[model samples]
Target: MRILVTGCAGFIGYHLTLKLIENGHNVMGIDNLNDYYDVRLKLDRLKELGIDSDNALHQNKTVASDSFKGFKFVRMSIEDRENLPQLFDHNHFDVVCNLAAQAGVRYSLENPEAYVDSNIVGFLNILECCKNHNIEHLVYASSSSVYGMNKKIPFNTTDSVDHPISLYAASKKSNELMAHTYSHLYGIRTTGLRFFTVYGPWGRPDMAMFLFTEAILNHKPIKVFNHGKLERDFTYIDDIVQGITQIVENKHTAAYNSDNLYHLYNIGNSKSVKLLDFIEAIEDEIGLKASKEMMPMQPGDVEKTWADVSGLERDYNYRPNTPIKSGVKKFVAWYKTYYGNSNE
Candidate 1:
């Protein structure tokens, strides 16, 4: 299979690309490498796959490197329709794993336009390209945030997702709707994975895990929002990647009543963890007590999130095994090594 993985330099995308390449798939990866966080980390991930960090985006070129057999890196953005069509036509990709998006709930309030441009418009472009070409499967990253403010215990795929509290959540919900439209209208096979709070090594700096780790290491007071009374599924990166890999190859049939060649699943650890317990895990891992600063919950922040991944498990035999303690320990170890913090 030849796969087109957008946001290849990103946290999830980088891991997924490497997995696909390892599984003997021809993979073409693209990312603008925007400075959402540290570009150095993105470059370092690319280096692991043997991509040169020397201004490859400046030339708008695709480099065929031998670090991973049949892996090619292209510096491009999903918003660029002209180049995207050309790339699609040239490669005739068998599958597209769409992971590129402006992905922060709190940041979306400040920069709503970025979410609209990248999540909504850019996704439409992908739908158009997949429709034009004879692509086999299209897997996109949706979010558990889409179940905004719902008073549900475990968020399920069948729950009504019409009420979105944040712009980022709204954009993800819109992507799901748009993908369903593409599938219904053009017979395009699409699957949307609603990811829960994913955390592990090579995590995003904007996420809670990275922020808490950085603040703890820097001897700054870590803000404990909602009086340390929040819960998250906290799915590990490896588990999330495994769910994605299985779904990318498993195509859905167009059933009239229950299915339409379009499906959605919650990929997450079924159990939720409290904020205080999560922090304790980190504290235990780094062997440093964090100075706590109690604060009210920020806008677009949820009090708790639990995912119902029964659909994923039944369909794909998926089970997330990494407990919060083990996952946090792995992340803290990577953080210390990556930042050269001896204390951490």
Candidate 2:
């Protein structure tokens, strides 16, 4: 299979691209490599895949990996109307996994325009390219943030997602709607995955796992938002990659058919962990106590997120099973190694 993975420098995108390459699929990965968090982290991720990131943005570069024979990477944005379509015109892709979006819920409040460009306009370009290229399947990233302000216990895909609290969530919900429209009209097999709090090696710095770990390591006080009352369904990277790979492959007996082409599912670790308990896992793994400061819940934030992945498991026969402690341990180890201190 020839797979085109957008946002290849992103946390999930980086992992997914590697998995696809290992599965013997020819992969073409692309990203804008924006400085939303740290461009260094994004560049380092690309470096891990054997691509030089020097002057990447300046060149709008396309570099093929020498290490991975089947993987090539382009430095581009999904919203690049001319270039995105040109890329699609030149190469025939069997599937497209659209993970490119301006991420971070809090940041969306600060820069809503970025969300409109990357999440909305960028995704429209992806759908248009897919429609034009006759791509067989399109697997894209949605978010659990779409279940905003809902009091539901387990955030199910079937739950009403019209009331998104944040711009980021709104943009993601819009993507799902757009995908559904394209699928219905153009016969594209579009699947939207509502990812939970995904955290692990090469995770995003804006996410809780990285921030807490960084704060703890530096002996700075970690902010316990919502006064330690919040809860989350934190899914590990490996588990996420596994589930996404299955979805991209459409290998399950109950996978989407021509009649059921437009689909959405919650991909998450089913169990929800309290914020304090989750912090405790990090403390236990890093062998350090975090200096904590209780803080009010930020705006556009939900109290809890719990994913009912029953539908995904029923159809795909797989569920995220990484325990909190184990996942934290792996992340801590990766953090220590990625930075200077491997002894921790």
**Per-prediction TM-score to the true structure, in the order listed:** 0.96, 0.97
The pairs that clash in candidate 2 are none
- The RMSD of every model to the true structure, in order and in angstroms, is 1.9, 1.3
Candidate 1 clashing pairs? Answer: none
The lowest-lDDT stretch of 10 consecutive residues in candidate 2 is 250-259
> Highest TM-score, which number?
2
TM-score of 1: 0.96
Among all windows of ten consecutive residues in candidate 1, which has the lowest summed lDDT? 250-259
Question: What is the C-alpha lDDT profile of model 1 across 254-340, one tens digit per residue?
Answer: 221244588899999999899999999988888889999999988988899999999888888888899888899899989888988
Name model 1 segments beyond 4 Å from true.
251-259
Q: Taking the tens digit of each residue's C-alpha lDDT, what string does model 2 give over 1-344? A: 99999999999999999999999999999999888988899888888777877745544567888679898888899999999999998889999999999999999989999999999999999999999999989999999999999998988888999999999999999999999999989999998999999999999998999999988887889999889999999999999999999887765455675379988999999989999999999988877899999999999999999999988898877667799999999998898888865324
lDDT of 2 at 21: 93
Question: Which one is best on lDDT?
Answer: 2
Count of backbone clashes for each model?
Answer: 0, 0
